[model samples]
Target chain A: MSKQVFIPRDSLNQALERLSSKMNVWVPAASGSNKCGSEFVPYRPDLIPLLNRQTTTPPKAVVFPQVETLLSYEYTKDPDNPSRVKIQLDDTSAGSPTLIFGARPCDARGFLLFDQVFTRGPFTDKYYRDRRENSYFATLVCLEWDSACFCSSVGSGPTDMEGSDLRVTPLKDGYLVEALNERAEPILSLMEGDVPTDAQQQDARKLQEEASRQRVGNVDLTRSATDFKGRFEDKAYWRAMVSQCLSCGVCTFVCPTCYCFSITDEMQGLKGERLRSWDSCMFFQYTLEASGHNPRPTRFERYRNRVGHKFSFIPEKYNGMIGCCGCGRCIRSCPVSIDIRRVVENLKENACVCA
Target chain B: MEASATTRLHQEVEASIGRLSTVLGWGAGYDPLHMTPLFVRSPEDIARLVWNPLCVQNLTGYLVKSPGVQPPEEGKKIGICVRGCDSRSLVALIQEKLISRENLYIIGIPCRGTVDIRRLMNESGLSNIRSVRIEKDLLIVDDANGAHNLPLERFLARRCLRCRHPNPVIHDVLLDEPVTPRTTAEDAYRDVESLEAQSLDQRRAFWSVELDRCLRCYACRNACPLCICQNRCIAETRDPRWLTQRVNLPEKFLYHFIHALHLAGRCTECGECERVCPMEIPVTLIKEKLNQITRDLLHYEAGLDPEAVPPLLTFNPAEAGI
Candidate 1:
């Protein structure tokens, strides 16, 4: 663990302004189109007020955009042989290193989760990896917790900065800076020396721990994940449970761990780019075949998959640990207020009946 | 035994439709050899119900298209007949809340693999084949060569060969004695796996050679049960045209990739996409890869049950190994 230092609360604006000169700094900005604020924009120190609140959009857009042009190509007549076909590169401009400010702890943890799923796989996504490497992350430790916040149960919480390069904790005068990765070293090196004493580290730790305890954030999901597979055949129960669900994918769109995407080619004139955008299984067409057959045509099966994957299948495939990070985003965002917490609680209590 | 099994299955369907008609006042019918939708209004019409090798149509696809049945005002239930695979789809639909369990009176059949008519046609190179008859486990194909005997298992639909669960996972009423669930591991995608095992260059070569045969007919896309976004697929859309109007290798590659990616985790190993491909493209190869991905990444199978959540919407933070 790196030592933390305090910067005067008033000097934050100046610090942001200094950082903006080097590279285009991206802070959460209001997206007028969606009437939602939180999309990253080029540095504007005036937007520091938005940093305290958690971003509406996850920081993922900063790295892996909703739609990206991986490579563009165009067809033109060859100079030497007009009859011969030739494919030429259209553009090769890549995004520069961006500094993302005020990312929440959950969003930071989301990056770590994405790292494992995307980086460890057989196919290395160069675009995502490159953007990830170039981007500098600085997260603000959460002082407040919501009912939707359950990161503590899955071993990560509001204060956990497992994936951040730099972590900032609010202090009386300003902010306490802690560098967690090599990338953060440069930023810390630039700061005036005011190293956090041993007492300060203890204080921060105690504060974070007490906050976690006071909020009662951790809900025991151990039994649910361990024993969920056996209960898969409980058709009557699961079917009844999800009978009220609407197959809208809002929960997925808001979720940080949902990496499933669909690829589409966009052609402009003779040039085209194949882009991958987020896709959800909740849609009717997600599993429906043109032959007019859909295997998962029911809401119960989709809901069961949601629970089974998080608790059983994911743990079985990755390790004994459950797949859910206990980030209760799904419970909060579901249109019908379908509480995953209650489901998990029921599963945990009923685990004794399972093998 | 096969004939009796089908007849018994037909009888069960009639009984359920009868029960549903009395209470809910709705009914079902069976299409003949072709995939034309069925409409049954009476008990006598149920005699036309045939569960032969030619029943390649996914009956679940026709359920949403009711025969003049309105919402709650019209009736309380919608009666239909479903095979084992069809029942899984129904379960998925019910679990997803697309169709209420209360609304459906399903007569579930335990399927002993359906025959692949396309594969049979290809083997004999017969264009004018008349009809298909199943005698026990033997498939009798009446073509230019009169009648030829083919082992049922040999020409069985790929989905049915490795079918471990041959009974409707969810059903209100079941028909015919459930056949002993077979653990027969049919190497359905062994060829795709072998091809994938090759180096990237070799794999590229193989795909190029195979795709070279594509005529860009879009038959495979038309045949897929999961491909319902035909009205607005990005490839053919005018608003933001995805590919060139001219048919070429690159355009075909894009179309295929989009199709495969669309079905990734959701594909239930149904071979309808490949069956309808006029160029005989093994479109299931893409679905197989996606199945492998879903199994490996999330350990979840699609369309196995109605209550299982689709993989894309479901996430486990713990699975991230945080």
Candidate 2:
């Protein structure tokens, strides 16, 4: 945690206007894609944009959105208390502390794969832990890598802080930063300038370890989570390997790590609210049933429950760690191109023909 | 790879429902083996019409189960029938003006494959087959293990081994004599194009070894007749129950990411969620990689033209040239 730079770009816009006077900063900049020049914007600290590569959508939509309004009722009838139910909680946005900045090391390792499903163990999501504890995050160090980048196979790269607190790098005119959380050492000791020598932190750690060995190398994932909990009944090899699935739903909305959701109730007659979008067990209406039963009722049991919920149930509930963050974005958004690395090399050649 | 076009499209749909039931007195017997929806009103019950391969239902789900799609006291207009994916769902319900191709008569036919009679009574042990018949390239199937025969592309049903339009592309009549078209395999999506020859830890070890047996149950969205919202679903709503009916594995990875993103760009590859999955789940290779991403990034083709449209209700915000 020792590297400071800055060299007057308004001292990084006065440390993003002193973290935007205590809340909401975002940054990134230039939102206008169509091939060529500037795209990833979120801005306000005088329109950020120093350099970016990802963001057609993801910064987990400023904390998971694409459609949000969890509650909103209003069926009034209170002639001196005749019946009451109001129901509100909708227009949110008050909780602030954001910051964000550059975000790149594969979107800061997709917030360590969304803090292992929104903050560890059994349910802890007060709206994604109150906007991820009033945000901050940081990260940048990519310098290059696309054709739908892979997060260097799985260990992550383009910088990898496992979810960043403060990272940066760039430098011929401005950045270096570094920190990596202890709530980023009082914003890197209220960072205001110099402290980058040792040949510019060994030339930004040898160009971030040669841009993480030219973008994505070690992808061995050598079979562990108890070797797929000992081959879960190989249904004739995932039914002759998912018969060219056309189940749509573009690889879980460009997954950084997919998190499914769906619940709607939009009301009008007695005022309504219940809403919770984002569902896709590869759709036949996400496991439909109400007496009509549908146990994964096929697309190959919904592509084998999307490859057994990312390698045997998110590693039997987060211990084996593999709900997919390799980030090839569902193999560059499959459309009959269907290739989850060839269904994991045909489940490692059907686990070497079941040993 | 050839023969069998279901006995010449059921003798050109029983002679075009016997000339639309002798000049519209109401085409013969409308018996879908009497599972209801009758009204052939009578023309000698058109010799109790029949079309083997037990007509695998979807006669537009019996034309919205009859009543008033036109049959209201009319002396005999409703004859119906159909095929090419049930007349492209009656041309997407007459281009969504919801049914009115002149009060109705249709017939159509031209299909070739059908029999999955529950995989032919689980591969011809033939339980109580009784009468099955098809003839030209065999099928037969009589009872207590007698008749037999077989050969129909073995059993058919991979959407009739890649059916190139079979016949009723729209239909109003044209029942018999079509059948000669058979050459499919346009590389039958080469197993979703050999999944770009794997390596991202073998596609995350092939979807975590098949979503470790998801049990969230919804019969692939109720035998999906275009999952037309069966009584409002977001996987069984309950205030903000955003999916936690707890079948496990982050709710079966949030129920296959909200059932493959609500069939993005409207999935119409129709394996009926891999023929109603009871944990058989090949969910059509995620709707055949979302029908090859709406036909290579939005050329769009779901339910082929009932006036087409729906590639995500029109969006080309400069074609995500964003």
Candidate 3:
């Protein structure tokens, strides 16, 4: 049996505090003034984690931040040889061990897709790899799902423990914590909790079984990628599905698996830093060329590319792992309430018609 | 009474459906509590149209956005449904000559106020909503748990709370009786006054904390009908780049400053920027402060008069004296 501990409801904060002392800890907590809504914030002793509700902002930023400085450089004139200049460069490779507490399975699975692009590739992104190497995820088994949630549709379930270092399942009084990997064993040992009895362990197993069996979304997207390619040239279909898209980056910004980024050099008088920030395919500038020619100039084409990237391209390249984790933040946060499930499912029906 | 108003709105659109090549309006979303912008190409599509406080989107931006269904003829007009604030956006578009008034058949609706979804969820402590109903000043929300009754004032969008215009200033056809304005001109700047009263450092600290949470998604800029520089926004421009892609507090602050400065004299107080912000940042407050300055300095209010030019857009050589 995996090393298991039972933390009572009141001791949850104390446990988080203990974890924070060893390493940086992030937990889902209320953001701004919205008590019902949550975002992943750095855990403090005073902060209360909202484990029952899904965070509005995904925990992807914990691994891949919205903005990161790769390196900083300064150029100075050489007194010995005025013709040549001396360059000083500062490499930013320093990273501390991080524990992302209260991340849902869907949020944890997002990193699995990101791993294919960043760490598992021939040319690995060292910056991302450094963060990935140092981070550990304590993912909660999701039981509460709203209309917008559809994690199961994209091959991830509420109880899916694919990328989790620690599996946390909520109990009536507290939580049942199980260490999944070697990295989590130290943290599990530090937790001030009683070893869970066989009854508690059985209860957790039952809950996980029930959660795994539940279907949150109504679409069967097994052949979604093949269907998406068939409708690539169908502008009328794309227009019908995504006409209300505001071309805003809300969908991409809130998405867990969207890893598209743009790198730029920022310079102040003599010193400068190269920065990488999140970029969205939905933006017109994402495809804007040097010659002022944009292949995806309109919302229709841009929306199509977004759907295709998640459903077709990524799955083809990464061996059938759909880019979308289907946490449904995009559906919930979208100004126009455009449903991606309906769009992707429509593509499948169109393929059937053609077949 | 609200039901009757919705019925009357349907009747008016049904009557005008034949003459209109396309009618832009709000329709039922995935849930009843929400509404999505709908494009009505035929009379059959009119049934999807809905009118309620939940219809929060300012549909004026669609006039500039290319539509899938085009007009039958080159000069044939497109129909649009506008609320009090949305009408101002339409007038501003006409004033700038970006869209001609002749090419639009405006269907105006006097709005009481739109509910902020975030506020409603917070106030009611309820999600997974089955349905929502507005009666007088109370909002009734039904979910799987039970029914919740919340006061309208507690849940109204921040912009709607201080709305000075509840009736459309200009429209081809008025669908309902004019609704009374929720707030007066004197009360409009209360929040702005409070923010201004703070010491410089206190004010700086206030914004620094709030703006630090911004993801720099640019949803606020994209949702604004007046922000016409869709693709070439200075925030994203590379040549002579005004701002870097850094997600730091200073860069975020500068991006908002650029957004506010660009709309110094032109913002119509539509509140779409604040509404669409996923971070719940009070972005419209910055625009309101700018508007307050313009009101005091130049005695100008934007989107009120179609014939009048924006004060910043035009200069008076004789009145250069402060």
Best by lDDT: 3
Give each candidate's interface RMSD in Å.
21.9, 19.9, 3.9
- Pairs clashing in candidate 3? none
Ranking by TM-score: 3, 1, 2
Best by TM-score: 3
DockQ of each: 0.01, 0.01, 0.50
True contacts kept of 2: 0.00
Off by over 4 Å in 1: A1-3, A29-42, A77-84, A89-95, A191-206, A212-218, A222-226, A287-294, A320-322, A348-355, B1-322
lDDT of 1 by residue, A1-355 (tens): 3445666678776777777777656776653321222345666766643554444446666776655665677778778998987787644546576777777777766766567677777886777787777788777777754445577766666776777888877666667777887777766655443677666667667766665555325476645665565557777556434433444465565566666666666676767776666655664445566676877666667777777866677656666545665555565434334556556666643432210
TM-score of model number 3: 0.95
Give candidate 1's error at residue A348 in angstroms.
4.7
Per-residue lDDT tens digits of candidate 2, residues B1-322?
1123334434544555533432211111111111111234334344434454445444453344212133434443456666666666566556545456666667776767665443554455554345555677677766665878888778776665665556677666665656753434354455566764688788666656456443344545544445554435676564445764444466676667677667665655445555444334455676667666666766655665766667676655677522
RMSD values for the candidates in order, in angstroms, are: 24.2, 24.5, 2.5
The sequence of per-residue lDDT tens digits that candidate 1 reaches over residues B1-322 is 6577567766675656644542111111111123323344446556555566556555453343221223433454566666666676666556556567877777666778776654554354443345556788887667546877778888776667756667777777776668766543235446557878899999888678557545444545544545556445676554566764444578778888898898766766656666544344566787788767777677776777676787765676677522
